[model samples]
Target chain A: MQGAITIEGVDKRYISRGRETVALDSVSLNIQPGELVSFVGPSGCGKSTLMNMIAGIVPMTNGRIIHNGKKVSGINRDVGYMTQADSVLPWRTVEKNVALPLEYRGVRTQERKQRVDEMLKLVELEGFNKSFPRELSGGMRKRVALAQMLAYSPNTLLLDEPFGALDAQLKMVMQQQLLNIWREQKKTIVLVTHDLSEAIAVSNRVVVLSGRPGRIKHIENIDIPHPRDVFKVRFLPEFERAYDSLWEQLSSEITKGESL
Target chain B: MQVDESAAVGTGLNTGGSSKAVLAYEAGLEQRKMMVRVSQVLFAIVFLSFWQWASGRIIDPFFVSSPLAVGGRLYEWTLNGQLWSHLSVTMLATAFGFFIGAGIGFALGLLFGKFAFLAEVMDPFITALYSIPKLALAPLFIIWFGIGIESKIAVSASIVFFVVFLNTFAGVRDVSQIYIHSTQIMGASNWAVLRTVVIPSATAWVITGLKVSVPYALVGTVIGEFMSSNRGIGYIIAQATGLFDTNSVFAGIVILMVVGAIINGLLKKTEGWLLRWKE
Candidate 1:
């Protein structure tokens, strides 16, 4: 069976101003196909760095990432990444922004048009095809961004704290929306989030990472059912147990980062 | 600002799909447009009336010619077709110079912006040329290219080229990293990313530069005319000044201002049409 993602002996290092900074050290993890995984820890745990490697955006200093039994070299069309900022093209309307990937891949006129239309509907932005990004609210822009990423129908999604900037209401709404979209598509998702609660709310498994030169501190398999409720997540005894356990592990990582 | 209201209404009507509502909306828009025009007319009358009165009684007509005298001079020139010929020459020179200069400037900006080494090599030469009074070299342009439209076009184009080049260079260079990352994640090739991501991002800057350069082209033409041209509004102004015809000078300046306004208005409209994506 082809695992969705297999990271073997991965080490990520960045050399800046002649000082070598090891972002990740021999971090190894395996993501099963269709697994919704969250990389969670204190800030500077290199969650984003590891996600970047999985998506082939950042080259690992050592080791390799294999997606579908193929060693990834550069950007693979099957992977879709949504970073912290919703960098929707200012020039394109909502529909056009969603259709960007298809356009670049030379998806034919009729099919691309239909996919754009369908994606807009999927993201509940059916009527916002012509609205520019500036005209959109932050939450609405984020939705457009989600629509754009989902438009390409990528088999895997790497999201870097996409809901980090939103108001609480919008964030919860987006978390649910992402879950619903994930339910519909069942793509392998690697989400990097600092909010431990958000990680627990969405992911099938939460990987707690250590401080700088991040390594997996703890891996807890979430037994939560699909169509999970963010509001009810905190009340679940299992949720509290997992969160408390992860916090205990993460506390020292954050403290170590500050001390350094 | 009112233009924005109608646009919102237009958007509202588009999704509503009610024919009667759209028809009523269109009629309402027309009414607003008529009211706008009427207000403009009233404002123009109030201002011009004050001007005419001031020139006739409050101020010396010698210092500031009465609107009537200028109108009469404009009428005489129009009847004799002197205004038409002179205006055409200036218009021709301005149009040709504007296109050539804008074209060259835009191309160079894109090239230099894309290639940093090229930009570095050309920076000193461009800066040196930019600082020199473009008009001061008009006589030399005339000597090199002669008294034809070629000289005028060259002079105007040289003036316009630098401004547009600088703006376009900035526009292209400032392509957002976020957008680039987004495109890269989408697996966009270098050329595809440049065309879709880079070019659109920089269009607002390029368009702004072009709009400013439009009037610069006219200045170039008029400057060239001051030095050597036998036609154009600049040529007419030179003749009028030789004979101390201040009225004609005012008339030429007035006409030039009007043309400049019309060109700017057109450019703004084109920007509205094309760069509607710009915030």
Candidate 2:
């Protein structure tokens, strides 16, 4: 109930050198608290723009977003945003990276350490506390980034292609871990990804957007039961049906995007 | 099961053979190192011998002093405590100028880096000051600081400031935007971002600037001493030139060389410690 998000007539435009480009059209959506929703679309569909708008990093040309009962203005610090790039600070050890947000919040040293250790364990990176980001493998570093975002226990999460760079096997493992965490934490999660199957596997509802000036084209409610295994969920008939419908909707947008 | 056991045995033997190959490679490396050392010693001995032989025979001893004579002069200076006094004076000037210049440069670099408008406004002025040959200011420095160690320090500091400031400024500007953005999203204040992200990120550049300016600091100090100072290795060299004592001049040059090498070694150690994460 605390992490519910409301978007109404949200529009985003970028103006450079007196030329204006529309990134997102008038879009509206309501995300209930503790719901897992995925935004799947072609490249340049402004999926990331929608994510940034919710996080309040990018200002909307018109319209507004509401997180919980509060209006989204400036940086929405109540939500943790994990960017697509490797966002872990290379200089800091894994433990230090996870503790960064806590430090910013002025958490006491004792509690910060305890929380960092707990978060690292949650991400299954218990023994890598002292290791630098450079020393960890790509997937391990991603875990550190995940732990860092979850360190402060923000009620909402905006993950922008968090596992896009990972190999297929590693990506599935991370998805499984994310699902487990989401189930346990019961936080509102908005995932923007290009992977169609990943959307059906992790999200309770899949929102497909049209290309360039992104607008919500279709929303499918995944009928799969809770605690679905990411590996096995794809084989389910319901999962396949959702994927087929979403892919059909998404592929047309990709072709339109290329032509434009 | 039999196939698996044989494959394991094969891997074990391969590991042993590879380790032996590694040992042989290490031995080869040691031998090469020894060869380099021997060759270096031989080159030094031969070069010194030729210089000593040529000083009186091929060229006048007045112009090119014999190595033995230079060595004797160094010994005499050391015995009379003149070497230590002059060496200390030069070292003090270099250290003072270096620290002052590096400190001011680092501070200004951070300040300008944080305030882009200030950096842009001051760009032309900084460039003008930097372009003026620092050594050419030695006479003015001597007049202002009055031929004391202060003048030498001023000369050294002025030269070192520019080198460090430019590097630090570039380092600050080159900081990754993603890092800053992520830190901000984590609720870091501007000061917190600078302290935790900007400063640490720019450390490699700062260290490089410091390392590069060490020689420049020494150059400024020696040039300052050459212009006006009554003491220092540069003074010894200037006085020897006036008296036509090429031996003392050569001795002074050798002392500066050794000092430079020692300072470089110390700087390398500091750089290693400061940037251990890089390794």
Where does the lowest 10-residue lDDT sum fall in candidate 2 chain B?
Answer: B4-13
Q: Candidate 1 lDDT, tens digit per residue, B210-264? A: 9999999999998888888788899888998898777788788889999999999
Docking class of 2: acceptable
TM-score of each: 0.87, 0.92
Which residue segments of model 2 deviate by more than 4 Å?
A: B1-27
lDDT of 1: 0.85
Provide the TM-score of the second chain in candidate 1: 0.83
**Top candidate (DockQ):** 1
Candidate No. with top TM-score: 2
Candidate 2 — what's its lDDT?
Answer: 0.90
Alpha-carbon error at B216 in model 1, in Å?
0.6
TM-score of chain A of each: 0.95, 0.98
Chain A TM-score for candidate 1 is 0.95
Poorest lDDT segment (10 consecutive residues) of candidate 1 chain B: B1-10
C-alpha DockQ for predicted model 2: 0.39
| True contacts recovered per prediction | 0.56, 0.42
TM-score of 1: 0.87
